[model samples]
Target: MARPLLSAHAERRTSVDYPYSETMYASVHHERRAAFGAELYGALGIGSGDHTARAVYDAESLRFYGAPHAAFLFVQGDGEARLAADVGAYMQTLLLAMTAYGVDSCPQGLLSFYADTVRAELGVTGGRLLVGISFGYADASSPVNQVKTERAPLESTTAFHDQGPSSESVRP
Candidate 1:
């Protein structure tokens, strides 16, 4: 299905104006998703530190009212790019799966800039950078929930190759 987006700035306000205090928002949930993320990393063979961001969930508004619930830091390395892609894709899938259980999430790609600080905080070695995913139930009322990000069309992104003996094409 196509993603949803907001039409204008005015439209954004009505989406996130929840009537609860921040403390009240966090208090409604018993799920420790950050801990789950850590455990998930350990089980999947990816090393993770103890860093976690806050996540907000509001059942009435159907919105997660806070910041990220966890952070994962990695150093610069030969496989960093591929590993990041793999990790991002895996996490996206995991979020979608959570939706089946009545949880919603948006991956906060913009928050990956705190690598140096996160590294210092976590005492990570090897001059690696930071990567993180903000996961939580969807805030139906948040303007973010209304904003839609675009994906490439298959025809626009796909490439075809000719093998001479037979024609071959690759899709990515």
Candidate 2:
């Protein structure tokens, strides 16, 4: 069965109105979102108006990416700015460590929607469910694994002072 993502209860349970999210979507975050969306849909060969094909592709992709393991990122604090900042820092550190160990990872906010299910499965009593990461050794043969998204230049997203040498835009 093809499951739709926006059931009525799902909207109530998962949708959150973050204050800065509006500003993000409206301005500073717009370019990267557009670029990423373009790359993603291009990779899937789905045109803008091809909603049916897009839906089928999304459903199939969910099942296709059945990675062996997923790790949830959680915090013992409420959804406060400081706590979310800490979570971001921790996730970055963890992802760096995983890369050093040759493990592939995909951080997922989608998993957090089913927070109740996660808490039940993991016997978690406290802490807010923040996000999850799916990881495994890379399967280089897979086209999905080969897909890459465009990132904004470092200078566009970062600010520098009279600190060190000339800041060069990092490219991957």
Candidate 3:
């Protein structure tokens, strides 16, 4: 039932404006709950009965103020070493996907600590906790989002060798 419901929600990615009000939040929460309710750990294969381990879990246990729009628990299966880099790459993919849908996201790595709780909850072994992603529509009015930081000039940021074998042939 939950799987079907989540699938339905994921399928409904048409033009819809989800305001930052409680009502819209409730709707998103319901879909999230439908997709990841009590059976969350179980669905991910680390329930109470089973002894299977995981690398990620819920953020609610952290006891923060406002709830995230949605949380996705990711485990480091097989490729634990490259998890962080892989995650960053995937996040950029998510950003592109969201952009197409008129939505925005802020891929965060700051939650790696809280992900510890997720590991503890899942009783995972070997692999370490990676990070958690908070996905939602960007608040346009947010000054943080609106402010675009500039980068150093390409020459300062990039390193390159002489274009030719002769020192006089290239300009540094």
Candidate 4:
């Protein structure tokens, strides 16, 4: 038997006037995804060319909110990407506080996919739901909770220059 989704955005068919805060996403460059594909997939234990394992992990990560309580962050439809930065900072603060209090949290961009669900339940309107954060005392026994991801070296992502040195003295 086929099951039904409780909150499918396709059924509502609402036009999203607000753009996703990601500039590359709005620009529609598929290659942008490919650029980070290796790092992201590698951290998830997805082997090179292992499409099946990748797909499974993707679905699993997107589904499981991983926490009991969720807080949605929304901004006015007219808000620009700068507003997203402020919201991100605020969210980080919340995460830090949660960590200090022995609470675990998961920040999921996947939550934004079901914006309609949030709107209807929370009476939210005139704003774009940018992200959702789920927080609760963690279940340490869950294998999913133990999954870890590695971060790329800062030098790989940053560029530095020596102002008082030769023109060729640049670092990456």
Candidate 5:
């Protein structure tokens, strides 16, 4: 598993750092994230006001949702936006391949918050932790697995130029 990740990372010829801006999600993105969170917790019988329940649920990421295997993705260089984009692309490909192999995977940004601890534990040096992926056979009967968040329609998220005003555009 590590070999494939390393190979892919090298092939991409890019090194990354953290994957988010200082503001993280803002405006509409923040709203969407909040809605998704509500949907997720609701599926688990947790109310929006249930702070205790939310904390416990969030802690599941630290345990990788009881996954048997995990992968930490890192890049060897200072933070660069281009390299971060490349890493993101690599992550998508890796996740797709895992799905094709019947492996269930979850990409956890929470892990990056403990980047220093992870590096210390792994005895790694000089790489910025980008993300961590937890993977294993999924429990088909789990209620959490049943949670599905709605996606914003393409017309509301994408802009088309040089086509015509009739074409879908996110602009006002």
Candidate 6:
């Protein structure tokens, strides 16, 4: 099953245009994506200017990073933001559970780009693809597996409103 899916994905290599509006991917998100790519490719000795090498490395996602099992998540709807959010939460919980059980998993939004190919291959109908997770034991010896991207600080991503309205604020 994985082989057929991989072959179909590779055959139809052209990913559809992003399913959501560009505004959703803000500058901060772009920065993080760039950082993650740099870390990953750098770990494999692929230079930033090497587009061919980058593409080859990225193609591994379709191969599920050689994981034995893959799961594609889909929500029944027309790509509503709320539905996507709910699926995202479900994915997080699923990933955490896999971790607790010592099963490695990588959630790939890249898979959603080829939703049509996936749907056709899996005989799925009437759902918006949200994400695909590849799960199995990770190859610890692989350099690609060694890359660790840093996370933004809590303060940078969160705001507190513990206190009531500020003294300078006008109340209704």
Q: Over the stretch 1-172, how does candidate 5's per-residue lDDT look in tens digits?
A: 3333333333543333455564876689888888888878887999989998887777677677888888888876655777777888999999999999999999988767666666766788877888999999989889889977788999998997776566566876
The most accurate candidate by lDDT is 6
**Pairs that clash in candidate 5:** none
Clashing pairs in 6: none
Per-residue CA lDDT of model 3 for 1-172, tens digit only, reads 1233223334542211111234645564565544443354544456564432432233222222122443433646576447657866876787788778976554434344444344444565545445445556655664334444344477865799866577567566
Q: Which segments of candidate 6 are over 4 A away from where they belong?
A: 1-23, 163-172
Question: lDDT of each model, Cα atoms only?
Answer: 0.43, 0.66, 0.46, 0.64, 0.77, 0.83
lDDT at position 11, candidate 6:
83
lDDT per residue (tens digit) for residues 1-172 in model 2: 0123234223455432222244646565676677776677777677878988867565442232566777877777565778878988999999999999998888866666656666666788877777778778878886666678766789977897775554685656
Spell out the clash pairs found in candidate 2: none
Which sequence of candidate numbers ranks them by TM-score, best first? 6, 5, 2, 4, 1, 3
> 1-172, model 1: which lDDT tens digit per residue?
0011111111332221112233553431323444554554454344554233211111111111353354453534566558656666777677778678876555443233334334444576654443444456566675445545344476765898755553455545
Residue 62 lDDT in candidate 5: 69
TM-score leader: 6
Clashes of 3: 0
Q: How does candidate 2 score on lDDT?
A: 0.66
Worst 10 residues of 6 by lDDT: 13-22
Query: Candidate 3: lDDT of 119?
Result: 44
What TM-score does each of the candidates earn? 0.43, 0.73, 0.42, 0.62, 0.78, 0.83
Residues 13-102, model 4: lDDT tens digits: 433424545653633244545645666676557777999897666544334444557788887645577887788889899999999999
